[model samples]
Target: MTGVNFQFTRGKRNKANRTRSPATERVLTQLKMISQRRKQPKLLQVCQEDHIRHETITTAFKLYRQEINANRAKLLLKQYESIKYAMEDLEQINSYLFHEANTNQKGKRFDLEMRIPTEYPPNQIWLHDYTPAEVAEKK
Candidate 1:
């Protein structure tokens, strides 16, 4: 039987596609403030004095804003992590593909080429003599 990579997500759908963003914190803070203001009409009055719109001062608006912020934060965090991993992969490929060649002459040069995951093992093998473990350790 094949291995199951299924994840049981109860609260949030498509959570794996999401990332946390810096703005999420700010949105959550605003939602907190909105809930607090709802409990105290005096604070809401103060917001009105500050020229905050009535639509923004509502509980419904607060809920929508909170949801939007959460999604934004998730996307941002995901993007950041993806970029980070991509850079790491690039570094890995570079280290494996390019290296200083050893030469006996006063001046000598050599070329190196690499292809990633060319074929499945045991039929597929890396072009060079170095083992995968050795190449990884070198980097």
Candidate 2:
């Protein structure tokens, strides 16, 4: 008569080759067909056609939201950069016009004779760190 004695036994595990239910098999087949056809099926359409729960459909394509968001973010970043470049160009033009107006006030009619410069300054455009530590140290 000890405290408490319990016997534990491990049950046989299910085999990997276990068959899926017909409904599950059909849903999987429909998903594969949709993917192969390159058709972007709407959630409601998939739910109606596959006769599966919306939760199941969402879980199966869980990574899709991340991919879509990533693409949207990339496109937004590109648009932002283009707009920034355009703004910089406009600012440069405004400064040029201001300078021309000042010169005209001083009796020089250069704005009508001289074409405004549209090209950006060479030192302004950059894809990486424009001012390196070495250059800053030299300055």
Candidate 3:
């Protein structure tokens, strides 16, 4: 007596062609769960950091305005204004940095170490070594 062997490949191909199958559903569900658990926390962190940086920059601007108003010397006023404008620019840069950091991207932090020029013929100032965190806390 000889035994007959039977194998089926057609069913496998048919299953592959079918949509809304159990395997596909399971895979999609797993992917969605993973994404929700991971990406959301990061986004939240970014948002918080952005808010903190914004508040800091705002404070810096207020202080700069006060300083500008207090000075009576003509040359000092001009220098104060230049520093103020440069600091405003620095604030914008910090916003960009915070955004970049939240996105897990690298960016230059604000530099407070550099002297903001007080007297120049063109009224220009250079900002260096400042980070968004530092710029925000600056008075």
TM-score of each: 0.28, 0.28, 0.20
Error of 3 at 134 (Å): 65
Candidate 2 lDDT, 35-98, residue by residue in tens: 8856696765454547656667887688788888999999999999997787677668797755
For 1-139, candidate 1 gives per-residue lDDT tens digits of 4764554556653536434455875698788888874454454444554555555568678898999999999999999999778767766778543332212445232333333444565443456564454465578
RMSD value for candidate 3: 22.2
Query: Could you give candidate 3's per-residue lDDT for residues 1-139 as a string of tens digits?
Result: 3575444444554555555668887899899888874445444445878999989999999999888777656778799999778767766779775455446535554455444565554333444643566466675
Per-candidate clashes come to 4, 0, 7
Error of 1 at 95 (Å): 4.6
Q: Mark the regions of model 1 whose C-alpha exceeds 4 Å error after superposition.
A: 1-57, 95-139
Which predicted model would earn the best lDDT? 3
Q: What is the lDDT, from 0 to 100, of the residue 135 in candidate 3?
A: 60
The residue pairs found clashing in candidate 3 are 109-130, 110-129, 110-130, 110-131, 111-128, 111-129, 111-130
TM-score of 2: 0.28
With candidate 1 superimposed using the best TM-score fit, by how many Å does residue 13's alpha carbon deviate from the native? 69
Top of the candidates by TM-score: 1
